[model samples]
Structure formats: structure tokens, C-alpha cells
Target: MNKQETHHHKGIEIFGKKTELYFAVLCGLFLVIGFLIATFTALPFWFSLSCYLISYFFGGYFISIEAFQKIIKGGFDIDFLMIAAAAGAAYIGSWAEGALLLFLFSLGHALEHYAMNRAKKSIKALGELSPKIALLKKDGKLTEIPITNLKINDIIAVKPNTKIAADGVIIKGSSSLNQAPITGESMPVDKTYIEDIDNLPAFNDIDKKHIVYTGTINGDSSLDVLVLKLSKDSTVSRLIKMVSEIETQKSPTQRITKKFEKYYVPIVIVSVFLLCFTYLIIDENFEQSIYRAITVLVAASPCALAISTPSAVLSGIARAAQKGVLIKGGKALESLGEITTIAFDKTGTLTEGKPKLTNVIPLHNFDEKELVQLILEIESLSNHPLAKAIVKDIKSQYKILVTNKASNVNAIQGKGIEATYQQEKVFIGNIKLMESAEILVDEVTISKMKALLEKGHTVMLIGLKNKIIGLISVMDLPRKMAADTLKRLKEIGIKRMIMLTGDHQNVGDAIAKQIGLTEAKGNLLPEDKVNAIKVLLKRDGKIAMVGDGVNDAPAMALSTVSIAMGAAGSDVALEAADVALMSDKIENLPFVIGLSRASKTIIKQNIFISLAVVFLLVPATIFGLTNIGLAVAFHEGSTIVVVLNALRLLRFKTK
Candidate 1:
């Protein structure tokens, strides 16, 4: 059958819906009439024969067509086995049984379609959320056009609450935009017009003045943006492409399973054929031999087992995605269930990784406010993360409006910032910077800094006119949910949780203790992280690694299951990970682990049930204790049972 001809638009195809209803009605009527008549009527086998003819034409015709197609393609699929079994049942004077098989088979096909349609709803939702049109500007006049038709360098206008159609910059207006869908960020961002265009990257920074990407929502204020890229060039496009690549690259187990089936199928076929031939030779009856052959074929078909694992895994993946967790595939799902140890990247994974003022120590009479204000003055001249922390703290502390361009300002790489503030040379940096500037950081101040550092704070020294005036410590602090998540994991049989970081040991240790973890390793480069994971695995524990930054990609690749913290993690990190947490809630960790374990269990149960029925029922039918009708019924029944077993994955939850 041509797929296109049968394909129907989801919401608008009236004919397709009516046809489906018609088929369903016919199936229900035929089954009810046949079963009731066979049980209640005193009519001969002729009555059963009439009911079978009506039912077979209604459902069996489709199966026969599909089976013939498979034969022509040189593929001996379950479809062929099913039709043959149904046809053989009719030949041996078992009319009602063959009709029953057709009815059940049709029901299974409908259920399969329902599952597929449900799964595709996610992609459809994503598609519908994207904006369809954009306002394009040309020759100083703007015209509204479909977003797909807009090209590079075209300027567009975006209203509040409207989705951004393409990746571009802000040229004419400034607003706080919500980029949650694109970046997994929870909050809106304030984007302003670029003042220094020359400082920006020259390559593909289309319209350095204004840019917006597809799927990003504009803020309350309406703004004009330039279209730098179409859908295919946007960030989401790149992510989609990466995901496609990941899907196409099959797991090691999947490749091995395919090879196993390649050899397994032929051997099963040969064995079944020989068994049938031998039975026929001994019995010397053509009909008996053919019945045995049909029984053997039905038993040999691995539909139940074949569909079991993939269905459960696929359902689990869909469930995870709906709950803001993105797991790649079955291989990843399997690995997650077996993880005994989890290695976490420190900075963003554990800590908030954003500056919060922790402690301030004054040498003389200066208070926290004065020291922070002076530090902010020097920090405002630089764009380093530590510098931003000081500036942020000053605003929070005193509402000071520090100058953007500091006078007599000097920033030393890997050191601190020095600037003239209120006619005095104020310095803010690490201990080495103060020492290099000949500013004496007294032993008492050093001890105070060490005390704060030991408590998971980064210490920055502040000086006035070359004299050390105060000690300032800022800490990123652990996420509020981390402790609860860690405790829950321990209770759930995860023995150890380890922290890996590129930061100093002091910071890592403080966080580990606060979060109730005893194991902490710091100062690890990206490569060192991978080596550490290998070492952790050598201890005979299945490992899971969680990270968010670009640097964490290598470690993610090395773990048994890598879960990326999607809320703040880089695209590279997300792509490298097998599982991803859509939100920043670490509490979801236990939930994902539980879901994986449940899915695996269901898959195992399905395989066992399928194999048990095949091994037990097929032989009974072969020995003349059961007929072809019983064999077909068992075969189709086993397939339905396995499918329903796999559907249990959809109910898995992690709260």
C-alpha cells in the first residue's frame, strides 16, 4: 500500500476518520456474532463457516496483502507467519478460531498506531510553538511575510509575547526576552543594542545591532530585530541535527543484537523446517505435516520478544521527555538503571556558580559597604566573572552607581584590578596581586581569608593607597535542592556521590561537606575528569556523571550514564550527555534512576513471557493435542500481552 495515499491530516481528514470507524465497527460486529453463534446456536459447522467468511474478508484481506508484499521483498516477517497461520486454521475446519485471530490482530495494529501518534505529539507541540511569520524590512520599508521566506540581513519587528522567528540582534529596541526554550534558562534576559559593534565577532554576527532566534519569546516591550538566519541556521536547528546524528549512531548493544538476530533467525527457521519434515515423514500424511509446519512457523516468529525491548525503551524515553528529562535512547536508559556511583562536576553542577557576598573582614574602621563600594569601582572596569561579582555585590549593598570606565584603571590577567578611587590607589585581587604590589596582607588577614576559603568562599583582598584595608570573600553557594537530592540518592542504594572540579580544593571540600558528601576531588582538567571517571569505574561501581559547562563534555562521554544539567549547561554538554535534566532541580535525579529501573524490569518481564508461551504452546500444537487455531490464537495473544506489558512504562513517575 502507498503510504501517501493512506496518510491523513491529523485534524482535518474526515474520510480517513470515517474509514477507521467503519473498519472498527465491522471487526466488533463480526467477532461478537461469531463467538455468540458458536456458543449458542445448534447449527452445524456451516453456521461457524458463514461467520468466519464474513470476519475473514473484513480483516484478513489486509493481512494477506501485507504478507504478500513482504514475500515479494524477500523478507519473511511476522506478517507472513500471521497470514499463513490464519489461512491454515481455516483449512483445518477451525473457522471461528481464524476469525478470532484476525480480530485480535486488527486491534493490535490500531493500538500500535495510537502509541505512535501519542509519541509524535511532542514534536508536533514543538512545531506549533514556533512563530510562522516575520516582518521583513527592505529599502527602508517593512513588510510582513512568512518567517520561512525571510532571508539574511532582513530586519523584522517582534511584539511582546510573540516568538522570535530567526536569530538576529537588537538594532532599534531593547527588551527583556524569555529564552527558556532555546537556552533552558528559567528567567528573562535584558538585551540592549550593541554600542561597540567593532568589538563583536566579525563572522556571522549578522546585524550586530539586533538579532533574535526561532522559538525565543520576546519580552513585554515590542522591539525590532534583524533576521540573521532562517530556521535551518538557528541554534535549535543545530541541536536537532546533533540529536539526529546521535540517533543514527546505534549503540554497541543494538549492533550486536542485530547481528544476533541475523544468525538467530536462519537457525530457527532451519530447525523448525526440519522438525516439520521429520514429523511428516513419520506420519506420512500431507495435511498433518502442513499443520505441523504452520505451528513451527508461528512458534519461530519472535514478534513478542522483538517488539518488547524497543517498545518499553521508546515509551520510557517519551515519558522522560515529557517530565523535562531528555534521555537519548534504550542504551542510555539501560545504563542509567545500573549506575552505582555518580561523579558530579563542581562549579555549575553543585554550586550555583554565581557570586554572593559571604564575609567581609576590615583591617581598620571600614565597614562592608565601604570596602565593597571601593572594590566595585575597580571591578566595573573589567568583565571577569569575579569582577562582575564585586559589582553585583556593591549594587546590592549600597546601591552605588559605579563608573563604567574607571580612571587610572589597570587590570592584570590572573591577578586583580587596580584603579584610582576617590584620589587613592585601591587594589582588589588575589593574595599574589597584593604581594606583587608591595601591599602587606597581614598574617591575621591571611588567616581570616583562609577561614572563609575553608568554608567554600573565594577571597579577594582590597587595598587603599597601597595599604591592605579589608578582606572580602564571595561564594557561589550550593543549590538549595542539592542536599535533599544527595540524601535521597544515598537512601535509594547509591553508595557514593563524588565531586569533580577545576576549582581549588578548598572550594570543593566545603561544598562536599555541606551537601553531606565525603568524597571530593578538585583541580581536575577536562582530561583529568575522564581519568577520574575511569578510576571510579575500576572500583566496581557503575558511574553516572552530571555536568553543565562546555568543559564537562569530555567527562560526560566517559561515564556509564551522563546526565547534563540542561538549564545552564552548554549545547556541547547537552549533546554529549545520554540523559538531560530540563530544569535545574537536582531532586529529579532519583526520579530518572527509578524510571530507568522500572523500564528495564518491564522489558525483561515481556521477553520472559513471550519466550515462555512460544516454547510451551508450540510443541503441544505440534503433537496434535492442539490445532492450528490454538497456535494462531496463542501467537497473537503473546504479541498483545508483550505490547501491553511494555505500555506500563508510560505510567512511571518520579516526584
Candidate 2:
């Protein structure tokens, strides 16, 4: 459909639902008017009866239609039980009681719909974040076009203070962007074309330099952005789709409740029949017996039980989304709550993925400046994390000295780089790489490397023509919040936390100790990480693996629950992970765990309250303790109670 037609259809649908709610409210007002008239005024009997009948038709007509529809489909539902009870009340000549029951039932239905829609509002708001039209740059002139017409590589101009229309990389201009909508980050992130285009590791909002996503607001400077994704495939669009799918997935408790409902309705109907038969044998009054039977049906309709889990799950999902944690579904949410052990990858998960140039030690009388110059010439061609750190550091310090380029630079997997610079063979890597090159490291250099490794620095040997020349140390620093996050997880009942990495054991242990983790295992390949996760699962039963989502995909897939850290940019990670943290904040991990535990607790509480209400009210209604109107009140009241209780999750805070 065209946009206009699609919007028209949506408007009609929204109008229809609102009209239904309004009609329900109107029916309630008429029922109250009829009650007050009958009780207070000396109205004629036929006139009062006419008012009550009008109220009943207005209030009960839709419910009766729905009940009959279910019956025709060979099914039973709450609507069927409610309509039957209302009909029984009217049959017993209790006009006011019947009218009140239908009014309360219709009102409750409207309110329940309102509450559910409220819970889904955050997801719906995602659709509204992106603008409908974008400013396309054509022939050096800005032209407004629908975002749907924008394609990959199209250059779009974003004016200051305007919402970006699509996900794109900045090719020109510099600005700060507020990405709060996508990442829930509070501060405005600075963006520039020069630095970001060169260092664009991945398209994440947290990385916040080159990429501007749909729905983010640009600050104070015009930017020309090259579109990287179509409008529908943008971050906001995918998030909306994810949340919509999540809403359709039922939690374990909800699934069981659904099964319970199918049988519960039939059993309630049979029990009502038996209750009526017994009352008839005892009282010998058919009307009074039927009245008691209808009350029993109303009191045991299972409305509260039907609503219990979904209300809490929906609320929890919405709350988590607001906090920048995207839980795929209720199943994942439940599994996260039961996590006993969490395995963390070293780089990009616990530590900042970026490494820094820390120490440089020279050997064989090589000048430090010339060594840095040769290292930069060799490392400039490689894209390894350490290479980038070295290149960045050299460019900042010895930019003038970097006059020559390396020839035939080849990176050895898991080792380092080899190249020829200035008619001399050069190799820069770990001691293993030096050993592979048949370069001998003396005792003094080996001791220095050990000390650097012990201090959590990754040391690389600089070898020139089969002789050890110097050593460079780079450290991937822990994230500022990593220590506090680990401590908080411990506070909240996580007993086992381990750091798994491919780095050396000394380096891993040092990083782990800094981050408050006692168990650290290093020198693990990707497959070895998977094996470690398996071992953890065997010992802890329920383990969660958290990583940057690329190299750790296998291990994450093997764990009980998989979390992707800083996944807002990586499509593979987002798809592979059960839960994704949009920003690079490790502190959110504890919040997610805390939220999952709270949601599970709320789900159990809702179920208990619902079942408890049924257990208490059904017996009261079957005996002479409660009447039909009182039974309906308590039944509907319990449903509202459960819904309101679940809604409390919307206000959940990690603190």
C-alpha cells in the first residue's frame, strides 16, 4: 500500500479501538444511571425495567457477540462464561445485578486493553523516531525526498538540530550527535569526518564517531552523510521489529497458563452444572440454584490467571529496552534470571577494545626514534588492534620520521607482522613470532617482557634481520565500570565469574584482578573458549557467555544465555546474542541481571495472586457466602490487581 493509504488504515484501526473503549464507558454510565433511578426515584416499574434492559443491551451486546463467536468455533473463553452468568442473573429477575455485572466486565476489558497498549507504547515510539523525509544531495543541491527512496551510498545533508533520516557514515563536516533514542546514552557524542572515517571499526552508536543512525539528533553543525543502510534496515527499524516479535512470544508460565485455561473453562462449566444439581436437591428452588451456579462460573473464570504472566513480561521487556538492554524474548529473559556463572571475553567485553602504546624497550643499541619509525612503517599496513595502537601513537609522536613504507608486510595469525623496511628485513610480534623467525631473545629482554606481561601489558618483540632489536608493550585497559559491575553482580548473587581470553595467563590474570574477577583463564583459541564454556556449564549448570559477538559467537552459542556487549553496531552479534547491550557500558550487565530476577519474581507473584484469588473466591461463591454481583466484582478485581501489579515493572530502576 501507498503511505497515505497505509496511514489511513492505521488511523481507522486506532479510531475503532478508541470508539470501543468510549462505548464501554458510555454503557457503564447508563448502567449507573439506571441503578440510581431504580433505587432512589419512584419510577414506574416498566420505565425502570426499560432503562435496565437498555443498559444490558449496550453493555453486554459486544461481549455476547464475542462469546457466541467462540462457541461457534468450538471453543470456550472468559467472554463465554461472563455472558452466561449475566444471562443467568437476568433469567432470575435480578435486572440491576445483571446490569452491574456486564458494566463492570466491559469496563474491565477496556481498562485491560488500555494497560496493554500502554506497555507497548515504548516499542511503538521507535517507529516515530525517524523522520519520514530526508534531505538528499543531488547536483550539489539539497532536495527533500521520502526516506524510503534513499538508498545505500546516497549522500544526505543533515542540518543542525534535525533528526537524521537514515543510518549513514559521515563523509564531510563535523558535529556532535545525541544518540539517546537508540543507545539510551545521556550525553551528546562528538562526530567528525576525518578521524572517524579512518578508524570506523564497526557501525555502532556507542563508537559514536563516523556513523549517524536514524533517529539521532545532530548538534550545531551541518553534515553530509553517506547512507550505509536503507531506511527499513536502520537500527530503529530493526529494534521495532525485534520488540514486536518479542511481544508475540509467550513466557513459559504463560504457555502453561494457556493450556490450563483450555481445560479450566470446561472443568468450571461441569462443576457449575454439578453445583446447580446439588443446590436443586437441597433447596428445591430452581431459580436460587441456578443463581448460585452462575456465581460459581463467574468466580472461577480464570481471567486473572490468563493475564498474569504476559502483563509482567511485557512490562519487564519495555523497562529493559528503556535501559538499553534488548532481550530477544520472554524465554531469554527467564533464562537470564537463572544464570549462575558468567564467562567474559577479555577484549571489547570487559576491557576497552582499544589498546594504548605503553612501553618501548630497545636492544642491540637500536635508536628508540628509528625503532618507532620502522615499527610505524611496518604496522601501518596491518589492521590488528595492537597495530592500530602503534600506528596511532607513532603518527602522533614521530610523524615526520615516518618517511618510508614497508614492503610485503604479512600478518601471521595469532603471532604478529613481518615486513621489509629500508632494504632491511623487519619483524614485530610476540616472543613466539621471534622464536618462529629463529631470533634468540637474551635473558635481560625476556625478564623485561615477563615484567610487562605481569603488569597486564601485551609485549611484542621488534626483530630486525633475525636479531632481537626492541620490545613494544600495549595494554588494553579495563573499562571504567568493569570493576564496579563485577562487584555488583556478586552483590546480586552471581557466584562464579571467569575471564576467558587468548592473551597470556599473566596478562589475563592482571586484567582480571584489576576488574575484581578472581578466576582468569588465558591462551584460549576460539574453539578452546567454547570448550571452556562447556566445562563451566558442566560445573555451574547455567552459564552466560558475554563477548564482542564476532570471535565469541561459538562460545556464546554454546552457553545457557549469551549476551553481546556493545552490539548496537554489529549485526552478527545482535543476531547471535540472546540479549544485547547497546552501549559499551559494562555496568548495564548487572542491571540486566537484576531486572531479569525481578521480572521472574513478579511473574511468580502474579501467578500466586491470581490462583490464590481463584481458590478463595470459588468456594465462597459456591456456598452461601458470596452472591453473583460480589463474585463478578472479586473476579474482575483480581484481574485488575494482577495487571496493576505487573505495571510496577515499568518503574524499575537498577539502584
lDDT of each residue in 1-655, candidate 2, tens digit only:
0001011111123347564466567677777777788789997777777877887876776667666765887977666666766676677666776666677566545444442342145355556767999999989999999999999879999998999999988888877676644542222455877444545444554344577888888876789998889988987677556545544344454556446656877788889888887754696577677778877866776557656666676788889999988876565677888887899987777877667788877888999888887888888887554576788977876664456578888766446679989887788887888898899988989999888879888778999877898999888788888998999999999998999886668878998888889699987745577789888988988888887634465566667777888643244445556788986677899989988888888878988998999899989987779986677677778878888998998998877
Q: Which residue runs does candidate 1 get wrong by more than 4 Å? A: 1-252, 255-263, 275-280, 397-400, 403-406
On lDDT, the candidate that comes out on top is 2
TM-score of each: 0.64, 0.60
Give the top-scoring candidate (TM-score): 1
- Give per-residue CA lDDT, model 1, range 265-286, as digits (tens): 5565666567666653585576
Tell me how many residue pairs clash in candidate 2.
0
Error of 1 at 214 (Å): 28
Model 2, poorest ten-residue lDDT window? Answer: 1-10
**Candidate 1 structure, TM-score to reference:** 0.64
